[model samples]
Structures are given as structure tokens and as C-alpha cells.
Target: MKFDCLIVDDEMELAETTCEYFNLFDVHTAFVTSAEACREFLREHEVSLLLLDINLGGTSGFQLCKELRLTTSIPILFISARSSEDDVLIALDIGGDDYIHKPYTLRVLLAKVKAVLKRWSNEPIPEEDGGLLQAGPVQIDTKLRRATLNGEPLKLKTMEYKLLHYLVQHKNRVIPKEELFSGVWGDIFAGDGTLNVHIRHLREKIEVSPKEPQLICTVWGIGYAFEGE
Candidate 1:
């Protein structure tokens, strides 16, 4: 069977409640209690997105995310009670699409999930000016939501694509962190760690050397600039 979303968390009560609430509003949601069950469920069903918790019956969600990323590109949103910047950074670094702090309101979670699903299921934005945007050896096809480095396809997640596209659109300018957050996430209150991690991931994909990135350069006390060709 196919589901729009799958909730994988050991907090059985919360997971079940969330699943029920989502289904009440036609989200077509399901819940599982452990990583083992999640794996088995995936084997038997098709899920468009995942709401995964960090701790799952002695198995880390980080490890599961790493394993799943090898086989899937579905969006993974980590839901946990841990709210430290390091936790958020680690979640994004480990292939998570977004990190939502626990003790969450159901309404907010539903809004976020719906927004992600809407984005996930849509085709790429059509370029208003048309054609590919080139930066050094990299190419971004806005119409296809595809990016390539040295003529080879780059596997970028949703946030990565949005960040890169925004940076390229404002190339040669040092965009403020606040501006980037507002522009990409539609939330000016987004944490710096979130932006920093996405920038690091973008560097890994588009730069010849992520350690010393020439394409996306840090502006010291300011923000980032895309020095494109």
C-alpha cells in the first residue's frame, strides 16, 4: 500500500496521535514504533515522506537515515525533544531534510508536513528567463530542479537546491544570513546552524574542494557570496 507520510518514533502515544490527526485531515499517514518495524514497513509499502525520531528502541535515527539515504530520496524530517544547535546541525548533516523540535503542536507539524509534501510532489520551478545558469563547471537547470558539476548530475536534496538556486540568483553579492533564511525558509527566525549546514552541504556538491570553497565564499562577519562564472 501507499501512504503520503510515515511516522517512525518510539513514542508510541505521540506517533499514534499524530498519525490519527494527520489522517483526520486526509494526510494518509501511518505510524511505526521502531527502526526494525520501519524497515519492514518500507519493504511492504510506498511512503512519500518520513517523520523520524532520533531515538528508536536502541537504534539511532541517524544510522537509519544514513542507511535509507543510500536507497531513497524521500524527505526525512527529524522530530526530537533535543533542541540544541548541534543536534539540528547533525540532523541536517546526516541527510535529514528538516529538524523539528518535539513538544510540538499538531497544527504546526501538519502545516510543515503539508508544505514539504507540496514541494516534494511538484515539478521544478520554471525559469522565468529560461535556460541553465552556469557557475564555473556547474550547471543548474531551474526547470528540472537539477544541478550538475563537471557535466555529471549532483544529487541535491530539496533545501540544498533552494539554497543553491537562491545564491546563484544573487550571485556576486554577499547575501545576509537573515535574508537567506527569510528567502529560502520563509522564516526570518530560522537558526544560523540550519543555514550553515545547508551551505556546507552545497559546498560539498558544487565546489571542487569543499574545504576551501571558491564558489560559495564566507563573508566573515556577514554572510555568503556566490562567485559565479
Candidate 2:
């Protein structure tokens, strides 16, 4: 009924092999070969996370991810051979949590998956001074694990929330990319592309004009800083 991970890939052999490897590591994984099968499987079982391939039979993983995001916020990691920056950006724009290129090492993939699972399963990081954190027009309720911009709720993904929380926690001070990786993601393996895309997403949600952001500013060659009123 409940699975730790599900691989939705048209490449049956690869999916099966990955599934086997995850299971061997006690991850409770499963595999589905098409968008339809993936939908059916989700209807019947609970999956903690998804490993989705961009190319699926008849329907692309992009389509499925967009559809799924309408209802679920579960972590979706896109696995594809398409290594172009465009594809990676598209995947993140369409609600994917992370992108993993093809020819991945099984152990590395497992470690990433385990890290995500741990983040979702555990409680939010406790704040020494627990309460609301305001940065300009945005308000972060650390206790409720929710954020609001201009009095309206901001629909943030798991990592987005973590990123914003960390930024607001140290408002007006530059936070290096390395510090963000360690503080928010709890792993330094995440690339700048991943962090940049998430920051763009956050800007799109909270800024009146995302093109000219006021709350979150980039300190070129350094990192980002959250400027509050």
C-alpha cells in the first residue's frame, strides 16, 4: 500500500533494475512503465517519492508531472538522458524536485533518495526563536511551516520553503551557495542550477515583478540576500 519510491519509466529494463536495487537496499520501491500505469499505481498505492523519465509512452513525464502537481506536492525527481540546460529548467519549472541525468550511479541515486526521504519524514527544523519571520511583504510562519506574500498564501514546494526559510532567517546578510546547500538541503551535492531555479520560482511567487526582485537580491559572485523592510 505504501512505497518509498516509484520509478515511472518507459525503459522497462532500467526501471526494473533500479527498482530491484532500491528494494535490495530496503527502500520499498516499485516500477511503472507508462503514464497510465503510473496513474493507476498511484490510485492504488501511496508513494513517498517518484523517479520519472521525461520520455514516456504517448505522454511525456512533463505532462504527468504537471497533472500530478495539481493535487500532490510529493517529491518528483526527473531522470532523463536529456542533459541540456533547457530540459533541466523545464523539469524544475514543471514541479520536479530534482533532475538526475542518465547513466547514474545506483549508490549515488540511493543516497539522494534517502536524503529526500529523511527530509520529508522528519519534523521541520526547530528554530531557537520560534515565530513569524517577516521579510518585506513576505511572512514566514516557521511554526506552521507556511509562507504568505502580500497577505496571500505562497504555494512553495518542500525545498522552496526550506530555501526561503533559511534566507529569511538571515535577512539582509549574504548567504553563500555553499551555506544554503548545507543549511537548506542538508547536502552539498546540489548544483547551482538547482538552487538558481528554486530561487527563480520563489521570486515568481512572491515578487510583483519577478524580473526585478526586491526581496531576494543576488550578491554576484557571492550568493543571495533577503532584504526586509
Candidate 3:
């Protein structure tokens, strides 16, 4: 079955063009003009991925992304005119999988969509928090979407689980925030503060004191690393 996708954008021409391109490539694509419409589509249909515009008829993609995270963990790719570094970081922080600038090649976009769909919807849905991914007192169960500190269950948002999962999967090394954003959320625009918020949340859940985190440690101004002793 073809993976379903939704594009939320105010630019009708661009949205239609993208939808047409995806359809041509056999990725079931639907286009909408606002977050509200996207919301409706999500409820009535099954969408494997989302192409969200940061500015949709003056609506904030960041806010929409935050809302989407609360419901489904489906992949979200952002398309916007904003090219600022901070904007990109905020996109990632809010749970968007990737960011795309205007004037992008439709071919590249299609390739990215296929890759994301394949990864997030990998064959054989992993069991809830499937298997234990452990590091010191911290544990990540991908299938269950849960993390643990010592023996206690650590409350983790969908994005937090993904961020930590990516960090643990590449443990013992200091990874750049951009790379983490791209890899964990998908290679897209991630806002600067997004990772910080999730990291703080993760630390609060795992670290005895977030001020002195022992597991997910910072690599100065670079990014983060999962330290296992």
C-alpha cells in the first residue's frame, strides 16, 4: 500500500504542485490550506507523513507541530520561507521531522518523503517500546515510547523519546545539534530552542538533578552525548 501524506500550506499553487509531484511518484498525497483543515484530515484519514508550512495563512507551524506531537508520532516535514537558523531550530524543537525552504526541487522533496516514510514506518511495526535500550540508569524502549531512570518510568514526550533514542543509538560521541535534529526528527529545519527544551525535559526525568545530569550530558556548546559508565 502507498504511504499517505498531507501537505499543509497557504500557497495553493505550491501545494498543488507538490501534491501532484508526490502523486506522480505514487506517494498518496493530499493538500490543505490551513492547520485546521490538516487537523480535520488527520482525524478522518490515515496520513503517514505531513508537509507543514511554518506560516500557513498566518498560522504558526511551530504551534501546529507542538499540537501534532501530542497526538500522533507521524513524521512531519516543514516547508517555509523562513531560512533563519533560529527558525530551523525551533521547527525541530517543536517536533517537526524536517524543514524545507521554498524554491526546492520536487524531485529532492519526493526522495526525502520516501526515505522518511520508509524509516518511520519501517516494516513490522516495532512493539510498543520494543526491547530495552539501556544506558546507565536510563533506558529507552522504542516500541513502548518510554524511557526509564534506574527502575522508574520516565515520562517522555514523543519528541523526547525520539531525541534520546537517537542520542543513545549514537552513544559516547558528541553529536551536533543539527545532525541530531536531522537524524532524529528527519533532515529538516529544526529551531534552535527545540532540542534544549526536550533535553531539559529528559534530564528532569532521568537526572537526579537536571543541573547535574549524569546520563545525557552536554558537549559544551556543540550538542549532546549519552554517557554510559
Best by lDDT: 2
- Cα miss at 225, model 1 (Å)? 3.8
Poorly placed runs, candidate 1 (over 4 Å) = 128-130, 142-158, 173-192, 205-214, 217-224
lDDT per residue (tens digit) for residues 1-229 in model 1 = 9999999999999999999999999999999999999999999999999999999989999999999999998989999999888889888888887888889999988988887777677665559557588777778888788888889999988788888888887888999998887678655445677788999888987788999999999999889999977
Per-residue lDDT of candidate 2, residues 86-128 (tens digit): 9999999889988999989999999989888887787776854
Clashing pairs in 2: none
Q: Score each candidate by Cα lDDT.
A: 0.88, 0.90, 0.79
Instruction: Kindly report which residue stretches of model 3 are placed more than 4 angstroms away from their true locations once superposed.
Output: 1-3, 123-133, 141-145, 169-204, 208-214, 217-224
Worst 10 residues of 3 by lDDT: 121-130
- Give candidate 2's TM-score: 0.90
Candidate 2's displacement at residue 63, Å, is: 0.6
lDDT of 2 at 27: 99
**On lDDT, who's better, 2 or 3?**
2
What does the lDDT come to for candidate 3? 0.79
Clashing pairs in 1: none
